[model samples]
Target: MGSFQIEGGHRLSGSIQPQGAKNEALQILCAVLLTSEKITINNIPDILDVNKLIRLLTNLGVKVEKTGKGSYTFKSDDLDLDYLHSEQFKIDGSGLRGSIMIVGPLLARFGKGYIPRPGGDKIGRRRLDTHFEGFIKLGAKFRYNKEDRFYGVEAPKDGLKGSYMLLEEASVTGTANIIMAAVLAKGTTTIYNAACEPYLQQLCQMLNSMGAKIGGVGSNLLTIEGVEELKGCEHRILPDMVEIGSWIGLAAMTRSEVTIKNVNWNMLGVIPNTFRKLGITIEQQGDDIHIPAHTNGYEVQSFIDGSIMNISDAPWPGFTPDLLSIMLVVATQARGSVLIHQKMFESRLFFVDKLIDMGAKIILCDPHRATVIGHDFKSTLKATTMSSPDIRAGISLLIAALSAKGTSVIHNIEQIDRGYENIDERLKAIGAKIERIA
Candidate 1:
């Protein structure tokens, strides 16, 4: 068990480079099982969840070699399809939701795949219905056995054939799974209402680099031209968008002047404008976002039409639901009030009680909405021991501690370690007084 002891009231200063996208890394790592040759993945995040997924891959006899820092070569020339029947495989796959992704490629190559229920941030109801349905559309049979909550999939007609799939939601993992399976299908595959997140974009680009034909790279509609086989190729991951959002919130809350380099600006379309509503000053220098220190804190702004401002998360080109927790904390320091709506995840807004404990005014309307009133920050936040609920909330709590007045202790940091790499070390490098303790 590791914890962080952070002293508040310090401005974090420095130029920091964002790591490879954790979301993308997980998706791409699972995509490796689709091919049998050496597939080089560059800019992979060296984080716990990623390492855990890598361990699972190696356990199945996949050849994995570290090529460089945040880079690796994965060869799936040898994989035990029956590895899923092992108790150890069940344990590892059930520990993370990304494991569900292995089903698509496995079924595509072997015509049969079995996996236990996947796990991830218990933020809300994350469904695998879309994933199963997508596979079904591509000619796969599913057996949902409640006794073990396991999913067993088998293709009836040789294997999955590319077909038009209209998804209910633009699920990132679901889209990735379909794309991987579709690449080896027999005809043109059109995915409607597909998740066009930057991570998915990177996945498509990588698939295209490997000789898979994909059109509409950054849109909700994707056209994948099925090929007999996808050859291996080198692909570099993109910078972490959620990490950039976290750092942006940290700079706003701690009044720090920090520069986030190579942020992939256009990818952050509404994120900047969304934060700007809280009166946070952000400078766009080419691909970097510069946040200046403002001890007084940013001011929360309402809509130009003067309606009570609401920040909600949608599929894409919308405020991401993942960052809603951090935005809630930022709104606490702003001068005005706003309603943070999390439509995608039901339990995501549940973390506001911690902020309320820290002297922020917040009303939890329900599991989906919360009203946050700026505290004016006249009183100092007295640190208390806290536990992390999920990856995003864990980091949000850390940011709250960073803006608090005294020493704060946060436990169960392994949850945080799953996504962010060496967070305490990274904060320390930026002049933050944070120490890790056992």
Candidate 2:
């Protein structure tokens, strides 16, 4: 276990580039298994989860070559199908949630996919029923080994045939997995209620580049015409929207003037405006976002009817649940009160207890909601020791530590490293006083 020792109340001023999309990189990296030819991917984030997936691919006998910084070429010509059934493979494959995505491409190419129960952040109940249900809907036989705790999907002698599936919910990974599996199936496959986040859009675009027919690229309804095979292609990941939102919160809470560069403004949707409702000034410069230091401090904006402001997460076009924690922390320093509802993940708001211990006024209404009464810069936070629960919450706590008075130490920093790339180094580049201690 490692910890970050941070001296708070420091003003940061500079421009920082957002890391490449973590969620998109996970999907695109797994898609490398779709073809035997070389698939070159650029702008891959150097985070723990991504590196784990790459190592998993290497273990499966895929030829992985490092082209340059944040770039790699993967050729799946010699994939070791036997390795998939090994105990070591199951152990390694269960390390991250993204590892589950490998099942789709593997099932599509080889007609069999095996994975142990995957492990990731303990935010809430993330079910795999959507993925397995989609696979079963596409004419594959699903089997679960209760004793071994493994999931396996196998196709018939003639291989999987396309079939229409309407997802119960717009699950992002489930949609991507089904799309990958359906691309090599026999006929056309239509999916409704598919997740339309930018991550899925980039996956669809990359699949099209690799010779897959997918329509409705940026909407809930997706139609895939199955092709015989997929060829290799080059793909680049966009900036991480969640990280961009965190930086905006960091700038606001620390009274820093920070500009997030090359943010792919078109894809950010309502993220900037959501923060703006907290009375934080967000200026868009072309593709960049400039968050100026609130010299006069910040306030919360109420609705036209003047009710206590509510910031909640929804499907895409809605405020992302991942950013709600940061929004909650930012609200703690604002001029008024706001209600943050994390509808998707129940335990995400549980970290508010740590913030409350730091002297912020927060009422945890329940497992899903938290109402924050802003200190309005009238009171400075008193730093203390804390532990990060998950990736988003870890970064949120880090932002709080950065803005609080005195020194704060955060343990279990590996959670933050799973998502953000070189975060401590990046923050230090912009004048943050944080040190990583082993």
Candidate 3:
């Protein structure tokens, strides 16, 4: 396992560009299997998870070519359907959670799709029932091999027939998977209570451009009319909003002046304003976000009734759960206390013990919530060695280390690399003292 050696108490300046959206890239990559024509994708982040999915596609006989840095052209003219049942595929497909998405496209275009139980962050129980359930609603037969922990879905002899589905929960990945499958069904498919995140909207728009008929691009109700076949088109991914939020928190925690370029401001939803609630200054410079140096510590805002401030995650138009770890870390040095409620995942707040060891005052009320008492920068966190548990927690720990007193070592940094692209180099460009130790 590789580690990161970080020298703390350094202020970072200059500008950093967020990489292509990791979540969107996963969905878009899977959509390439929906068509056999040449599909060119730009702004593909060179991260471990995305790369793993690309390799999985390559092994399945999709022709992939590198056109430029962060750009690739893929053609699914030929595919090895038997590879889906191979032992090698079982091992490769189980490496990342994104591999589950490929099943939808394969079942839609071809007749069958199979996948091993996917593996990802150990944050909590991430069920695959939503994806499989959606596939079943689209007239596909589902089966599970408990002994092998594998899932298989096959379309009917007449192929997939569109139907209306009201999801029990608004899941982003589940919605994307069902949308891909429905695009090639026999009739109209209506999905209610769907996730309307910008990335999902991008997926729908890309499908529309590729000859699919989709309505309600940015709403909870999506209507997809089945097309005989889909053609290929060029698509560019948006900047990762989660990474942009992380940079915002990093700037405030270390008292640095950093500018995040080409952030696609309108699509950021409540991210910028949510940071503002923590008393951080976020300036919009055209399409970029400029966070000036917080020479004095920031203060948390209270409710209109003078109650303590509380930040929680919800569906779209609400604060994202991905950045809650960053918010918890940033609140350590703020001027007042704020409550962080992580509603989606249970184990995400377990990393607070490491921060508490670093001299931050945080009360882990339970698996779902924590109250962070800010030191207001009067006390600096003392550096310590730690291990990264997941992607978001890893970056949060790295931010904490960068703002601490001495040097710190983070083991199992592969968790971080799975998401961020060249994170150490990118931080170095903004004057952050981080080194990757192999």
Candidate 4:
């Protein structure tokens, strides 16, 4: 496993342009199998997960070419038989929870698909019941092998027809899979409580251009009217909103003056105001966001009872559940006590023990909540080897290392690279000492 050796304590300063959204890229990449015509995607983030998906697509006999640095063109003139069942293919798909997203597109295109249990983060129980349940709504039969823990979905002979179903929750990838499958189904499909994050919206927009009529661009209720066929179209993905949030947290924790460029300002409705409560100063410059270094750390805002406040994670437009870990690290320097709650997953709060070792006064209340007491000693984290748990947790560990004292080595950097694009290269431009070692 590759590792990252990072020396900490120096403030991060520079202008960074976040690459395209990884969540968006993954869902969109699976959409390529929806059509055989040539489809081009620009501004794609060069990340591990996307590269893995590209290789998986190639294994399926899809033509994937790099036209430029961040541009990729995919065309499936002919798909290989028995590709998904190959050992290499199953192993690759099993590594990423996102790969399960391809099940819907594949089932739609080839009428049958096989997927082992997908793996991404160890953040508690991520259920595929939504994915399989969605498949059932599309008139497909599914069977789970208890031994292998794999799922296989196949449409009826006349091809699947759309229907009305309510998702248990707004599982992001689940919504994407159902949307892709319904796009090619024969009739109308209505999905309620669907996750309408920016990434899913982008997928819907891309499919719409390909002649899939999907109603509800950014809402919980989605009605996708299935069409006969879809033609390929070129699309440029929007900048990542999550990275923009991470930059906000990093600037507050490191007290660095940084301007993040090409941000989609309109999409960032509740994020800026939410971060401001913590005393992080954020200014919108057209489509960009500027974060100034604060000598005095952010303020911890409280509830109606005037108690110590915390920033928690939620679905889109609510404080993102993904950034709460990083925010907890930022709160350590602030003069207040707050609780970090992750409503989506149970295991996300497991890394706070490492922070506790670094001199931060934090109480692990349970799997969902952590009471972080700030205004502790201004100390440094001793160099340690840490393994990443998930994409967000991996980046959070990096943030803790960057803010810690001395040097830290992060093993299994592939987890961090799974989402962030050239993170070492980008952080180096600012002033952090981070090197990728084999």
Candidate 5:
């Protein structure tokens, strides 16, 4: 495992562009399997998980060509069907949770889809029940192999017939997988309680551009009229909202003046306002967000009722659970206290212990909540060694370390690399003293 040795107390000042949406890239890349023609996708993030999925596609004999730095053309005309059922595919497919999305498009085109138990951050129990239930509702037979620990979905002789499904919860990946499968099914499919995040909306728009009939864009209820076949089309992914939020938190923690360029501000629902509530100065300049240096120290804003502020995560248009850790870490330097409630994932708040050890006043109220008493830059954080628990926590720890008084070593950087594209180099561009050591 590699580690990042970061020297603290540097004010980063520059403009940086956020990478392409990792989640959207996963969805778009998997959508390539829905057609046999060449699909050109631009603004693909070159990260570990995305690259792993691309390699998986190549292993299945899809013709992949690199058009530019973050562009690719994928043609699935000669897929190796036998490889999908082999043992090797099971091992390869388990590397990332996003790999599970491949099943939808494959089942839509080939009548069969198989995937091993997916792997990702051990934040909490991520259930695949929603995905299987969606497929089952679409007239596909589902089965699980006890010994092999893999799931398989096979279409009936008549193929998939569209139906209405009200999802139990708005699971992003689950909604995406079902959407991919439903676009090619027979008749019409109505998905209520669908995730309307920008990434899913991008997926629906891309599929529609590829000759699929999907209505109700940017809303919870999606109506997809099943088409006989889908053709490939060109699509460009938007900036990663999670990464943009992380950069905002990083700029505040380091007391830096950094501008995030080319950010699609409209797609970022509550991210900008969430950080603004922490008393960080956010200015919108055209398509960019400028985070001015908080030299006077940031003060957390209280609720209108004079109660302690609460930052919580909900489905869409709410604060994302992925950035809760970043919010907690940023709150450590603010002037007031706030309640950080991580409702979605149980184990995510456990990383607050590491922040507390670095001189931040944080109380781990429970596995799902933490109360942060802002230090307000009165005491500089004392650097220490820590292990990254997950992707968001890793970046949060990096932010904390960058603002600390001494050097800190963060191990398990692979977790960070799985999501962020060239994070160290990007930080270096903004004058951060981070070194990657193997």
Candidate 6:
């Protein structure tokens, strides 16, 4: 396993640009399968997960060309449908969670789609029931192969018929999958309780640009009118808000002055203000976020009634669950304590043990909650070795290491690579003392 050897307690400065939204890229790339013409996508992150999906598409006979850095052209005019059932496909499709999204477009246009149980971060139980159930509501037949642990959805020979569905949960990927499938159905498809995150909204807008009739682009309820076929369109992904949050936390933890450039501020709902709740200074300068050095150290804000702060994740327009790990780590250095409730994923909070070992005060209340008591910078964390449990946790630990005294080693960095693009190099550019050890 690769590791990051970091010399801690150093302040970082200068500007860094956030990569394209990884979540949006995954869904948008899958949409390329809905059309037979050339689709050019720009600002695609050079991350492991996105690259894996691109290769998977190539394997399925989509003609792909690299136009420039972080830009690619894809044409799925002809695809090898048989490859979907091949053993090699099982191996390829099972490597990343994003692979599950391809099934929707394939089933929409080609009548059948199959995928091996997809693999990704072992955070919690991310059920596929939402995606398949939505498909079933649209008149697709669902089946599972017990022996191979494979899933298949096939539309009738007449094609899928649009229907209304109320999702059990507002799952981003699940919502995107259902929308992709519904875009090609015979009638209007209505989805309630759908995820309305910026990435999902981007997917809906992209589909609309491709001749799909979609309404309520940024709301929980979505309406899609089925079309015969989609035409190719050019799309540019927005900057990743998760990475922007990470950089903000990293700046606060290391007491650095860092500017995150071209953040598309209007799209970052609740993220900037959420960090402000922890008493971090976030300045909106043009389209960038400028976090000044917290030389005097930041403090946590109490509730209106003087109660200890409580931070939790919810659907869109709420603080994202993905950044809870970063918030938990940032809270460790604040003046007051906060309760982090990770309701979406059970095991995500389990990583607190690693932070606790690094000399930060934290209480793992249960699988879903953690109470973190800040050190107020009166006591700095001691460097130690730790293993990354997941993507967000990995970056959180890296931030902790950068603020801790002495040197620290973080193993299993591949988890971080699956999400962040060239994290070590990016840190180095901002004067961070980090090295990649292969």
Q: Per-prediction TM-score, please?
A: 0.97, 0.99, 0.99, 0.96, 0.99, 0.99
Across residues 1-438, which tens digit of lDDT does each residue of candidate 6 receive? 899999999999999999999999999999999999999999999999999999999999999999999999999999999999899999999999999999999999999999999999999888999999999999999999999999999999899999988999999999999999999999999999999999999999899999999998899999999999999999999999999999999999999999999999999999999999999999999999999999999899999999989999988888999999999999999999999999888788888889999888998888999999999999999999999989999999999999999999999999999999999999999999999998
| Count of clashing residue pairs in every prediction | 1, 0, 0, 1, 0, 0
Whichever of 5 and 6 has more lDDT, that candidate is 6
lDDT of 5 by residue, 1-438 (tens): 999999999999999999999999999999999999989999999999999999999999999999999999999999998988887798789888999999999989999999999998989999999999999999999999989888999999899989999999999999999999999999999999999999999999999999999999889999999999988899999999999999999999999999999999899999989988989889999999999988998999999999999999999978889899999999999999999999999899888889889989998888999999998898989999999999999999999999999899999999999899999999999999999998
Model 2 C-alpha lDDT versus the unseen true structure: 0.94
**Per-residue CA lDDT of candidate 2, range 1-438, in tens?**
999999999999999999999999999999999999999999999999999999999999989999898999999999989999898898888888999999999999999999999999989898999999999999999999999889999988898898888999888999999999999999989999999999999999999999999999999989999999999999999999999999999999999999999999999999999999999999989999999889788999999998999999998878888899999999999999999999998789889889999999999999998899999998988899999999999999999999999999999999999999999999999999999998
* Candidate 4 C-alpha error for residue 114, in Å: 1.5
Minimal lDDT window, size 10, model 3: 125-134
lDDT scores in order: 0.87, 0.94, 0.96, 0.85, 0.94, 0.95
Candidate 6 runs further than 4 Å off: none
lDDT for residue 138 in candidate 3, whole number 0-100: 91
Clashing pairs in 3: none
Query: Candidate 1's residue-wise lDDT over 283-388, tens digit each?
Result: 9998899999877867788788988889899888788888899999888888789999989988987777787888888899988899988865656555667888
* lDDT by residue for model 3 (202-298), tens: 9999999999999998999999999999999999999999999999999999999999999999999999999999999999999999999999989
Better of 2 and 4 by TM-score: 2
Candidate 2: which stretches are off by over 4 Å?
A: none
Give the 10-residue window scoring lowest on summed lDDT in candidate 1.
375-384
